[model samples]
Target: MTGGLPLSGVRILDASHVLAGPFATYQLCLMGADAVRVERIGGDDFVRHHGGSAELRTQGMGGSFAAQNAGKACILLDLKAPGGRDVFLKLAAACDVVMENYRPGVMDRLGVGYADVKAMKPDIVYCSLTGYGPQGPFADAPAYDHIVQGVSGLMSMTGTKDSGPQRMGLPITDYIAGLTAALAVAGALHQKRATGEGQHLVVPMLASVLAFMGSYAIDAQTLGRERGLQGNAPFSGSPFAGRFDTVDGHLVVTANTAAQAVRMVRALGLADLEPLAAGTAPDALSEADRARVAEALDRTFRTRTALEWEEALGAAAVPAGKVRGLGEILAHPQTAAMGCLDDLPLPGLEDPVKLPGLGFTSDAWTRRPLSEPEAPGQSTRDVLAGLGLSRREIDDLARAGAVAGPGLPPRSA
Candidate 1:
């Protein structure tokens, strides 16, 4: 394990918004990168105004925005304004990385695209995250998580036979794209360190989602069949590997191996059913045998509570868990032990807000001190100053409607 955060001293100029782009930069910030996001002069990130909590939304710290944007600064710049692009270019020159998620040509139209930034900072690692690849037929099409989910065939395969083409409960594609972009940026940064040469990373959400569903895609192509929604059933096709009803709740058991299937049956006190699995290969049971085993297990599981079955199956080396709600899981002892939530102190809120911490733990990685998500343009003055702009120049820019921030005079109506 390393002794400190790996990306310390790295600087990211983030012009991304919504989930994917912000999330990618947020991941890097969690690893100790100094990230400064540039919002439009009068506009905020879409997530900044929408989320579960109305109060937070009104405060410009919506729950969705707070989820991944902690520890980052914000500056507001109207790139269409006369000096706005100049200001962005200056910031880009000082940044080690520039990340944006605008559509294919929006950044170029604004005169702050990858080419423009690369011209200023030859070794800058630039990442352009979009819905589609930069040179595709659909490159100009706008997309959100749900759009990508539909386009990538994820929605088509998600639900049961009765509820066809259902969307996932969460914005899974956005998260996948974010993770992919973060990984690409990390790799590019590694290469830059090694060779002092930067690279442009074009991460498309559609491609990211497709890669995430590689297994299913390959299966569909190889078997020439679509495995329509099996609904809670493990893709491995084990009859014993799925959600089953219990007296009090539900339990999910994944007995994916031959030994595990046998052990699960035995643990459930279904000795009569043991023969069905004793010599059979996992996922290779005959249709009749599969139905029989599944029926027996389902009937037996109903005799006890989900937790009771979880304990018994777990002790028998079966992979099992009781279905839990978000609140229950968050409050679980295991979650507490993981220390994956950080308390952030926002200015207006009476109590500190709890946000997620680094998703993984390592002995070598040190946790950066928790910082609150910035309100739009919260750090405009300081960030501009860091770019070597004088107070007079910043004030002039604000007056000219090119920039806006707290304590600065509002842009002329």
Candidate 2:
């Protein structure tokens, strides 16, 4: 629905770092916004410790940061210094939106909170993303992705039934929070467009994560039923289910209705399951009968390799997919078919880096090519120049170690 690249002129100050904030800003960048990222001195983000590599240890550009920060310009600023705070407020007053992913009270302590910025620029959109919330009992609790997952009840639905309350393998809580923040900003911008008013947006990562868990929670709430992990299946208690092991890999065979189920059974070449389909209504089939049918479907699905099952499913118009790892998807033909893989140059690495493709398209072109993720604080001096800081003032900030961007690198020389 948002294919239009609607937010083209919008400029976003990506003060938020790590996954949640970066992911949201990335979305905005994809939608044709100028998203500038500001980082601390030395370019240190928490994910710098991802592996035991010398290059990564020094430069702090890990895969996690790269994934979130691609297609955005980056700068550096020392927010601790009084001069830094002054320059940051100046920049905040200049931008349409200011976004941050710090814990509650951090920005306020720095005197750059929404209230403080609102005084300087009345219509500025200020967004703060936190783990718990702006105000709550757990607001003071420090958190990471795993903690948010557990607190939001997402861990309850993550793994097998036996695994009880396990954290998700990926940083889903952080990611979803970013998406929520971006959505909130867009809504606020829309309102701003109409009223010429600015707003403060507080997005709690835990609450956003909880919204994801609510889909499962609603199903877990049937009169006396609590949803259990069937490993991987629909939360709707349907037999049109998931993750069947095949010869080469796994596949999820999901046919939510009897007709789709019939197609799925036929694709698996199970004539026996067809008769069971007749006894069960497409929508009204009891879970037990559906389970029995699903069991039969699983048996037949295993008869072929994942590739064969993919072909079989495609031929039958049934919803099916081979379970693929990240590498598998990148190398697979379907990823190219969907235009979700790209060959991009990365000078920092030995070879040109291959990465996931973009989401938006223009009037004629279906995809926009973007530069590789640069090191954090890469454009510290250049951005300040654009902010209209005089070369002399810029030189002073560089000397004071307060501001970064534009000709500052050469100051040490």
Best by lDDT: 1
What overall lDDT goes with each candidate model? 0.87, 0.74
lDDT of 1 by residue, 1-413 (tens): 55678999999999999999999999998888999998997674679877747778888888888888888888889998879999999999999999999999899989998899989999999999999988868988999999999999888778888887888999999999999999999999998888999988999999999988888888899999977766676866777788889998899888877789889889988888777765345446778888898889888999999988888888888999999998888878988789887787765778886667678877887677777788888899999998888998898899888898997776665
Give candidate 2 regions above 4 Å deviation: 1-5, 48-58, 220-225, 278-295, 341-344, 349-352, 357-367, 404-413
Could you tell me the TM-score of candidate 1?
Answer: 0.96
Put down candidate 2 lDDT per residue, 129-171, tens digits, no spaces.
Answer: 8888878799888888888877776766667867766776788
Error of 1 at 392 (Å): 1.0
lDDT of 2: 0.74
Global fold similarity of model 2 (TM-score): 0.87
| Residue 34 shift from truth in candidate 2, angstroms | 1.5
TM-scores of all candidate predictions against the true structure: 0.96, 0.87
Best by TM-score: 1
